[model samples]
Target: MGNAIGMVEFTSIARGIETSDYMIKAANVELLKSSTVCPGKYIVLIGGTTGDVKVSMSVGEKYGGEYLVDTLMIPNIHSQLIPAICLTNQVENPGAVGVLEFYSIASAITAGDVAAKAANITLIEIKIGYSIGGKGVVVLTGDVGAVLTAVEAAKKQCELLLQTTVIPKPSPKLYETLL
Candidate 1:
């Protein structure tokens, strides 16, 4: 079994709804407790195994502008960080180096699923977080080779099916030829 970590955020309510819908219906995910970190905003936490978790979120009616400015308040006594830090603190066995960070939560879930199915690796845990670009980020720690191979598979899958990139040209540049 292995673990995964990642996070993503969306700016627009429409986009967030789309993403959250994808996760709930297309991915058939279970919802964890919602967070009250952001005022008027809801942060839902959810996870399971490969089949259970499908990384997704929605932009609520409230916007998260500058909300992240608030410093995180993690209680010191036997908190969640302690366990995570302790677990990763140990040295990995041969062929079991923990997977680092993945580009997106979707990709990470896909990678973990692919690894479990194709490589017979188990996804012991998963962590999701918000990315700097407001996109989802996932971090997975599991079998070294399995994680790496899964990353490749997930990347390929993303390239083939998930990713949507847009390139924009300057308005003046486009109008120059017309003028």
Candidate 2:
């Protein structure tokens, strides 16, 4: 994992694969994730130094061409973002949760990174693509002020914000179901 993260989403899986290959070959970036998203889209996530990530995204965008759906390069992504997106960590009984919903996985990921870096919040989950019909959602928790600040940061990064909510305190059952 690195402070910088780059991602590209493509409308065509074939183009996405091709772009990813070019991107990896062109830069010293590590490929974090590359998979088919819901609604037949494809996404590639890479991590490295800011310069490397930027170089990779440039190559990706060039190869993506007309198939490109979205792209992002975060120079100082939050430390907790990748883990939450990968679903490899858990936070028990988080407080004052906030949710940000977007129309695309790439958008959600970009916004989530911004949110996480903006406040001292814990990223609970980043659900995207599959089973959600191409939509994406970011869930985070902290004190009410932190959650609100994070959500606002995310909103600034997101173009198609479908929904956003802040729950100061959720019921036990709701926490059980969501977390």
Question: Each model's C-alpha lDDT?
Answer: 0.35, 0.87
Tens-place lDDT digits, model 1, residues 1-179:
11321122343344443444455554444444333322223233343344334232222212334332211111111222222322232223223323424434344344444544444333433333332332222233345565566555645654223332211222445323222
Please state the error at residue 144 of candidate 2 in Å.
2.2
Model 2 alpha-carbon drift over 4 Å, by segment: none
Best TM-score among the predictions, by candidate number: 2
Candidate 1 local lDDT, residue 43: 38
lDDT of 1 at 50: 44
Instruction: Please tell me which predicted candidate would have the highest lDDT against the true structure.
Output: 2
**In model 2, what lDDT does residue 151 have?**
99
Clashes of each: 22, 0
The collision pairs in model 2 are none
Q: For candidate 2, what's the RMSD?
A: 1.8
The per-residue C-alpha lDDT of model 2 at residue 102 equals: 92
